[model samples]
Structure formats: structure tokens, C-alpha cells
Target: MGATINLLVMASMPIAKVLLLAAIGSFLGLDHVNILGEDARHHLNKVVFYVFNPALVTSTLAKTITFESFLTLWFMPVNIFITYLLGSILGWVLIKITKAPRHLKGLIIGACSAGNLGKLPLIIVPAMCREKGSPFGDVDVCQSYGLAYASLSMALGNFYMWLYTYNIIRIFSRDVIDDANHPEVGDESFGNNTEFLLKPTEYSLMTPNNKIPMSSKFQQLLSQFSGKINLKPLFSPSTIGVLVGFMIGLIPPLRKLLIGNDAPLHVIQDSAYMLGDATIPTITLILGANLLLGLKGSQIQFRIVIGIVATRYILLPLLGILIIRGAIRGGILKCDPLFQFILLLQYAVPPAMNISTMTELFGNGQSEYSVILLWTYGLAAVALTLWSTIFLWLVAS
Candidate 1:
């Protein structure tokens, strides 16, 4: 019992820090302040995405992940996929039950499906490792391995969130979304791209049948091939980090150069690590700013919010416990409590904030997404703390 109390405090402190930072972000985003207001927040998001996050991803992966760990944790990608699959099913049910608008169906499903796997765990896991009475033995060992797990989760989450959930939102948003103000629709060659791909080759210019060039055909084939396998996410920085880091950690020469004290180019790795350190705070602040928008006004129903909350916070965690424990019992998962703890944490987080941007990209139900995010995150302060405490107790025992 005493240990549980300590675990709660250990878990809660980092979350409290995140909440505090988020509140500050909200304050900065207020109309009166305008520091992290809409435009500024967008710019900051760009920085985090293209710069800070990638650096963090690469550094963490390179520093902690190894070929053995990668092989052992193979189920992570599958686990992430299950979260999306289950949430999507639940979201679809919600849409049908609530009679939600067709335009908002994808957004609803997306909100249910994608968890904020990156930011919170990055914050939570590291913070938990820092506590006085932590379960994970050896502070440095705990931090390193904990980060490896979190980084993998973040990479997988980012890949899945954009590819699967983003497409779901994009596909459903197309019919009802307004073309006039919809950013992607404004492109002159929007529908023409697909038309060009499928159109038969013209005989000749004189016959007024334009001959499609071989290059064009190949390009279309390439595009179709890429889309079929969802290749875009594979190239995302997080995935790249995983791939490159895996190589470095596995290969002797590269690993020696970037890791440990005596390496010649350790400075470069250190530089990246320093830059990567900025990721958590930046992500939290953006989360706060986005939540501010959600709080101000939303047409979303309370029941919808409750449904997502219930799905993410309660239902998914139960599923994780079963799946993970079963995997362990069946000898598929290692019994490392920290690794187990990280896997459990993956299931219990809020919806990915990137889903909000996705709705905006499709020009559908961005406001509704904001409202959903607000409630989930607001409740996560309590949900994450309690769940983390219970999870630690279970894993440690």
C-alpha cells in the first residue's frame, strides 16, 4: 500500500509538470497574449515536427535501441495496430449509435483509434524512472531502456496515426467538406492527377489524342505502388530514426562512433541529444494551446466525449492487460517489468493530437476534434496517474 502511494506520486509528478506546462501554453495562446496563438502555434508545430522531434527520435533510438531489443519488441507494431483497429471499430459504432454527420465519421473514428503514444510516454516513463523508490533497477539502465521502448512506441504511433487514421479522416471528409476554403481542394490539378494516371494513351497530337509519355505511366505506377503499401509513414523521421538507429546499434563501426565516451564523433550524437531534449516540453505546450481551442467552443456532444474517454482510458487498458499477459504466459513477451509497463502505457493514453491536424487537412470537423482532445487530455491528468500507479504495482509484483 505504501509502495502504491509512492508509485502514484512518482507517476503523478511528471504528469503534473506536463499539465503545468500545458496550462502555461494555454495562457500564452489566449487572445489577449497572442504569444502562442493560432498562427504562432502552427509555426511552433512545424519546428517540432520537422526539427525537434526528428532529432529526439534519432538520438534516442541511436543511444538506446539495439538489434536484440528491436527483435524482442517486434510485437510493438502489432500492438499499436490493434489499438487503432479496436478504436476504429468502437468509433464506427459510436457514429452509428449517435447518428453523427457523415463528414465527421472519419474524425470520430480517428479520435477513438490513435493514442498520443509519443509525447506522454516520453514524459511519463523518464519521469517515473527518476523517482526515489522506482521499480526499474539502476537509474541509467531504466532511463535508457525506458526511452528505447517509448521511442519505438512513438515511431510506430506516428507511422500508424498518419497513414491509417489520417487516410480514414481524409476519405470520409471529402464529400461534405467545403471545396472553396478547403486547402487541398484548391490545387488546380487535384482530380486531374488520378485522371491523368488512368487515361489511355492518345494516338498523336494531330489526332488530338494526347499520347501519355512512358515516364508519366511509370510515375503513376510508382505512386499507386507507394500508396498501396502506405509508404509515406515509412519515410517519416521517426521511422527513419528507427531504421538508422537499428543499423548503427547493430553494426560495430557506426555504433562505436556515435555512442559511448571515446568515440570521435560523439559530439554529433550529443548535439542531437541536446536538441532532442526540447521535444517533450514543446509537445506539451502545443498540446496545451490546442486544448485551449477545444475548451473555448465546440459543437461536439458530451456523450461523444464520454465515449472516447471511456474507450481510450478504460476499455483499451483492459485489452492491453489481457493481450500482454497472454503474450507473456505464452512465452512471446519478455517478463521485464519496465518493458511491460511501457506496453501497458501505450494503450492508456489520450488520442493523438496529430489527428486534429489531420481533420484540419481534410477541412472537416477540426473543431469537433479539438473538443474531443480537450476532454481526453483534461481527464488524462487523473486517468494516467491512477492507471500508471496501478500498472506499476501490477508489473512490479
Candidate 2:
């Protein structure tokens, strides 16, 4: 009973911490767009994307990795793929069963499968690892696994978000075209070859009278490259700092040249580590702010929230477990039980952060994505707390 209570408290502590941090950020007027300023948010993201994030990845991966450790990480991606596939199918079925419009299907699936691994787990997992003292003990290993997990989570989430956005855009464009071509609309002569394409940069750009404007060449080029732009790449101070740290960590020759063999390069490493630590906190604060912004008179239907939560928390995890277990039993996957559990936990996480961004880009179901994200994270925090407590108690016993 004592162990159970301790574990319960331990589990609840992290959730409380997250809630407190979010509350503090809220009270500080971070949620108010006018006060925080958009430029600061952009700069924060730029730091995370170009400098701190990639350095965190390379340093972590380089230090913690063995052949076996690298091999074990494959389980995460497999389970993520399985969960995504099953969640997509289940979301589609739900859409059809409810007789909902087809355009909503992409949003539903995207929300269910995106798994906010970066934002939430940054708080949850380290605490759990510290308590359990599992594979995360060696600072190198912890960094490596964290980076690998982040890379996988972000890449998969980004890919799916893009895919769903594309589908939503296609659906919306089809409707617009249908409307324009309708006989009762009385404007069937809107030009035969003209088309409406939604680009990530410009949202929707319309080509009218079946002619591309020569003056808009620069705009068209910008649209083509906007999604590919990784701003603040070469000269960003944070990027340079992290890269220098990563080089020191990974390359023995560089380490010898820079810091020498006497010392362990703790100063540089610690500085980079401190910056790395800031990445997650900054991300969580941004997410909290985004959620608050989204909640302003946003009419998110409760039914949609319920559906998204059910799909994300229940269906995806179930499907992931079954698929992974079946694969293991069939000798298709050679990963150990610990790796399998990690994969399962990854699937169990809530919607990704990028879903809201994608919804805005596609101009379809942004509100639904925002509502689902807030509710899903709130529910996920509760579920994780309860589940971790139970697991810890079982282990202790």
C-alpha cells in the first residue's frame, strides 16, 4: 500500500508540474498575442528548429548509442506506423458510420494519430526514467534515446500532417470547383482550364481566366519553396553553438583539439545541455499559449472531441499492441520486451502539435484539431498518471 501510494504521488507530481507551468505561463500573459509578440514566438521556434533541436539529436544519438541500443529503437517506428495505419482506418470508419462529410475524415485521422510526443513526454518520460533508473541512467544513453525519439516523432508527425493537409485541400478545392460549375450559380463561364491550388505559404492561390500572371512569378516561386524553408539555418547563433557542442561530443579528434584530453568538456556540454533543457519548456509554453488562443469562442463540438479522444487513446494503442505482439509472436520482429513497451507508450501518447498548424494550412477543420488537441492532452495526462502509478506499484511489488 505504501509503495502504491508513493508511486501514485510520484506519477501525479509530473502532471502537477506541467499544470503549474502552464498556469504560470497563462498568468504571465504569454497566452495573449498582443503582449507576447509574434516575433518572440518565431525566434523561439527558430532556435528550437535549427540549433537546440538538431544539436540535442546529434549529441544524444552519438553518446548513448550502441549497435544493440540502435536496434532496439526500431520498435518505436514500427509501432508508430501500425498505430497510424489502424487509427486512419478506424477514423474513416467512424466518419462513414456517422455519415459525416468526407472532408472531415483527414482531420479526424490526423488528430487521432499525430501523438504529441515532443511536447508532453519531454516532461513525463524524464521523470519516469529518473524514478525507475531504467535505460536512461547514463546521460549519453538518455540523450541518445531522447533525440532518436524526438526525431522519429517529429518526422512522422510532420509527414502525416502534410498528407492530411493535402487531402483536405483537395476536398475543399473540389467543392469550390463544383460550386463554380453549377448551372444554378449562373457563372459556369469561369474559364475551363482555371484551377485553384492551395499552397502552404499563400493558403489558396486562384488562377483565373486560365492564365498565369507573369508578374506573380516571384510569388509562385515563394509558394513552391515555402514549405522547404528552414529559416535561420547557417548563421543562427544557437545552431552554431549546438553544432560545436555536437562536434565535440561525437568526434574524438575535434574533442582533443578543442577541449584537450585532460578535461571532459563538461563546460561546453553543460551549456549545450542547458539549452537543450530549454527546448521542451519553451515548446510546452508555446503549446499552452496556442491552446488558449484556440479556445477563444471556438465552437468545438463535444462529439468530435470524444471521437478524437477515443480514436487516439483507445483504438490506436489497442491496435498497436495487437499488431506489435502478433509480429513478435510470428518472429517478424526481434526486439526485446522493453523496446516493445516503449513502442506501445509512444502509440499511447496524444495528438501531435503540428495538427493544428496543418488544419490552418489546409483551411479545413482547424477548430476541430485545436479542440481535439486540448482535450486529448488533458485526458492523456490523467491516463498517464493513473497508468504509471499502477505500473510502478506492480514493479515495486
Candidate 3:
């Protein structure tokens, strides 16, 4: 009982710190306060996206990751993919059960599928490592490894979220907007290039030379696939940071040049670290300001809210435990206990705050997405604390 309380306290402190900072941001965003108002938050978010995030990702990953370390942590990407896949399936089920509105369906699915992989873990892991009696081990070593795991997690999480969740919401939201504004003239315009590729077979059959070459058919299929999927988000700044960091860390000569105190060009890494330090606070502040919109409330259904919460907090975590433990039992995952803990933790986090950004970008469901973020993040402190405790105990055992 005493050990359990100790772990719980350790877990809750990081969450408490996050809530406290967010409280300040929320206060600042208030109409009376007017410090981190909408405009301020928007600019700050861009800074984080373009500057702080890349700096943090590059500095942390460069300092810790190497070719060997990268190989050892390979399961993490697979773990993140599993979480997204399972969560997306559950989101689809929820939409069906609730009969969610067209615009909100994508929002709901994106929420379910994308966890706050970067920010929360970045804060929680290092904080947990610093706590006395941490199950992982010595504080310094634990902090170093934990931060690396978290940084890599953040980079990859953003990659998947942007490519998968962003496109999902963009498609659905744009469709809803188009249907509303133009009922009669949908995708019937001549410029709809996707139409020709989609009906290539129909077009080919009509031709006198009825045998379309295999190469032509392959190119047509490729075009159709590319047309449906947006790949631009896959190379986001954070992801590029990860790639750059990997390059520096993996090569022995480059690693010696940039990473250590003795290196001549170490100033660059130090500068990046200094800039990266601002990422957490800046992101949390933006989060608080954005969440303020939730306070205004939306017409979103109560059942939908409950469904998303239950999926994230209850169903997903249970499945995570099973998958991770089964992996260990089957001898598939052989790495640091902290690495496994990070993977399990990935399954338990709340929805990505970026979903709100997407809803705003798509120009619909902004208020609705904000409301969902509010409830989930409001409960995240409790949810994360409990799961962290369980994960620590499981990994320690």
C-alpha cells in the first residue's frame, strides 16, 4: 500500500504541474485577462510548430539516439501504429452507435485515434524519473533515457497524427462544407482529376485499342492513390527534426562533431537545447488558451462525449496492457523496461490537442472539437496518473 501510494504520488506530480501551468494559461486567455488571447495563442502555436518543436526533437534525439538505440526502440513505432489502428476502429463503432452528425464524425474519429503522444509524455517521463524511489533506476540515467524515448515518441506521434488523423478530418469536414454550400454541383466539375483515374477501366473498355498497357494501368492506379492521400504532413518540421537528429546521431563522425561537450560545433546543439526548453510551456499555454473555447460550450451530444472518454480511458488502456505484456511474454520486445513503459503509456494518453487545430483549419466543428478536448484534458490528470501508476508497477514487476 505504501509503495502504491508512493508511485501514485510520483505519477500525479507531473500531471499536477501540467494542470497548474495550463491553469495559468487558461487564466491568461480569459476575456478580462487578455494575455494569451486568440491571436496570441495562434502566433504562439506557429512558433512552437516551426521553431520550438523542431529544436526540442532534434536536440533530444541527437543527444540520446544512435543507430543501435534506434534499432532497439523499433517496437515503439509499431506500438503507436497499433494504438491508432485500434482507436480508429473504436471511433468508427462509436460513430455508428451514436449516429453522429457528418461534420462531427471525423472529429470524433480523429480524437479517438490520435493521443497526446508528444506533450504529455515529454512532461511526465522526465518528471517521473526525477522522483525519488522511481522504479526505473538512477535518476540521471533514467531521465536521459526517458527523455529520448519521449522525444522519439513525440516525433513519430506527430508524423502519424498529421498524415492519418489530419487527412481524415480534412476530408470529412470539407465534404460537409461542400455539401452545405453546393448541393447540386458536387465533384462534377471538369477539374476533378480523380474522376478519370477512378473510372479508368470504364474509359479503357470504350477505346478501340481495348488493351491498356500494364504500365499505363499502374500509373493510373498510382495517380488515384496519390490523389486521395496527402503526403505533405508526413514531413512536418518535427519529423524533419527527427530525421536530421537521426543522421547526426547515427554516424560516428557526425555524432562526435555535434553531440558532445568536447566537439567544436557543440554550440549548435546547445543553442537548440536552449530553444527547445521553451516547447513544453509554450505548448501547454496554447493548449490552455485553445481549451478556453470549450468553456463557451457547443451543442455536441452528451453520449458522444462519454463514448470518447470511455474509449480512451478504459478500453484502449486494457488492450494496451494485453498487447504489451503479450509481446514481452512472446519475447518480441527486448529492450529497456523504461522503453516498454513508454510504449504502454502511449496507449493511455488523451486525444491529441492538434485535433482542435485541424477543426479550425477546416473551418467547421471548431467549437465541437474544443468541447471534446476540454472534457478529455480535464479528466487527463486523473486518467494519466492512474495509468502511470499501473504502468510503473507493471514494468517494475
Candidate 4:
């Protein structure tokens, strides 16, 4: 009971610290719009993506990972997959029941499945790890493990984004094409690209009939070939950073150069570690700013807010506890306190803020996403507080 109470107290500390810092920043107007400037935000994101994040991942994974540890961490993937699947299904069912537009269904599910990985794990997991007494038995290991998780989560998020975006585009485009090809369709103007081409447009318009001219076919082919190749994904700074870091971690010769007491690259690694340390606080502050700027009480629909909040905070956590308990009873997984806590932390996490950002990017239902985000966070804060208190009491008793 004492151990449980200690665990609960430790778990609550990080979340409280993050929220407090964010709230203070928001209240002080330090995080107000235009305070940091868009260019600064972009540059900071780039720095995090390309330098700090990868460095942190490489450093942590190299230090902590081995064949045995690798086997244990397998649970991370399973937990992520299950949560995503469950969230997606729930979102889809809700959309269907609401009879929302077909186009919105995908967006809704994607938003629900996407989580605030950056802030949640960085802030919450490390504390949880420390509480559970990781193999390293050092608080710093929490930060290191958090970084590794962050890298994996980021990679997964990017992959999901690409898949989801492609599906959305294909669905919408197929629908448009089908509408155009229907003989009974009275709207001749619906798919008329020639008319659109004749008129100057703000956005680039593409139509199925706009084939390349025969004379310019080779030139057009080359142009299309060049345009079709998006090297950005492959060669982007972030990709390069992650690749380099991953390689270094996997290769003992390179790994030796980056870490350890006698390492030549220790200084570089240390600097990166320091910078990586800043990521969590910055993310939390940004989240607070976003909430302060956009999430007004009046904008929320209480019933919808309650439903979404309950799904994340109540249903998910309870389900996760049950799953963990069942896994233990069945001997599917060894009963490790750390693993149990991790599963709990995953369930306790709030909705990903990135979802709302993505919804706005796709020009979908931003308002609904915003409401969902606001409620998710709000509910998570409350639920985590209550859960932590209860968990602490149970452990201490």
C-alpha cells in the first residue's frame, strides 16, 4: 500500500508540474500569439526534430537497450496498436450514429486516434518510470526512456499521417471522379476541368482529362517525374537526424564514440541531452497557449464534450486496467510493476493536441476537433488527479 501511494504521488508530480508551468505561462501572456513569432516556432520545431530529439533517442536507446530489454519494450507497440484501433472504432461508430458527412468520418477517427505524444509521454512517463524503479534505478533514466518512446511515437505518427492523408485524398477524389462519370448526372459542370482551366484559379486544379500534349509529352513527363518525387520525406533534416542516430545506436563502434566516460563525443551528446530536456516544458507551454487562445467555455457543447471526455478518461483507463489484469492472470506477460504503471499511464493520457492542429490543416471540422481536444485535456487533468489520489491512498494503505 505504501508503495502504491508513493507511485501515485510520483506520477501526479510531473503532470502537475507541466500543467502549472503551462498555466503560468498562459496567464502571464508570455505564450500569447505573436510573442514568440512564427519563425521562432518553426526554427525551434526544426531544431527539436533534427537535433535534440534524435540525439536523445540515440543516446537513450544505446544505453538502455539489449536483447532482453528489447523483448520487454515489445509491449509498447502492442499498447499503441490497441489504443489506436479502439479509438478509431469508437470514433467511427460515433460518426455513423451522428450521421455525419462521409468525408468527416475519416477525419474524426484520425483525430481521435492521434494522441498528444510529445507532451504526455515526456512529462508523464519519466515520472512513472522513476516511481516504478527502472533497471537503471536513476531518475535520469526516466528522461532517457521517455526520449526513446518519443522517437518511436513520432515515427509512428508520421507514418499514420501519410497513410491517413493518402486514404482521405483517394476517397474524396474517387467520389469526385465517380460523380463525373455518371451518365445520369445532370451536372456537366461538376467535373468540367476545361472550363476551370480557362478561368484563372487560386488553387492548382487537376482533372482526369488534362493529358499532356504529344509534342511536349517528353518534357511534361520529365516535369511530372520531377514533381512526383518528394525527396523531402527521405532527406528532411528530421529523417536524417533519426537515421544517423539510429545507426549510431545499432553500431557499437559509433555508439562508443558518443557516450561513456572516456568517449570523445560525450560533449556533443551532453549538449543534446540538455536541449532535449527543454522539449517537455516547451510543449506544455505551447499547449497551454493553444488552450488559452482558442478554447473558450462558450464554444463547447457540454454533452458532446462529456461523451468524448468520458471515452478517454473513464472507458479507456478502465479497459486498460482490465486488460493488464487479464494479461497478468493469463501469464501472457510477467507481472512487472513498471510495465503495469506504463499501461496505466498510456490510458491516463489526454487526446493528442496534434489532432486539432491536423484538422485545421485539412480544413475539416476544426470546431469539433477543438472541442474534443479541450474536453480531453480538461477531463484528463481531472481524472488523473482523482486517480492519482486514489492510487496513492491504495498504495500507502
Best by TM-score: 3
Decide which is better by TM-score, 1 or 4.
1
| TM-score head-to-head 1 vs 2, winner | 1
The C-alpha TM-scores of every prediction are: 0.86, 0.69, 0.91, 0.71
**For model 2, how does the per-residue alpha-carbon lDDT over 1-397 read when each residue is reduced to its tens digit?**
7666667787777677777776555544353434434556556666776766655544444344445555555655556666667767777677666655545666666666566655565566555555543433555545456554554455444444455434444444344455656545432222232233333444334366645565565566565345433332234343343344445545666555434335556465455556666776777666665665555535555676778778877776666667766777798776443344455566677777766655665576676666676677668678767655554443333
How many angstroms is residue 257 displaced in model 3 relative to the true structure, after the best TM-score fit?
0.9
As for candidate 3, its clashing pairs are none
Worst 10 residues of 3 by lDDT: 188-197
State the lDDT of candidate 3 residue by residue for 190-306, as single tens digits.
225433334635475334665656676677767655665788888999999999989898888988999889998999999999999999888887788778898899999989999
In order, candidate lDDTs are 0.81, 0.57, 0.87, 0.57
Give the best candidate by lDDT.
3
Against the correct fold, how does model 4 do in TM-score? 0.71
Q: Which parts of model 1 are misplaced by more than 4 Å?
A: 177-234
Rank by lDDT, descending? Answer: 3, 1, 4, 2
- Residue 31, model 2: Cα distance from true site in angstroms: 6.5
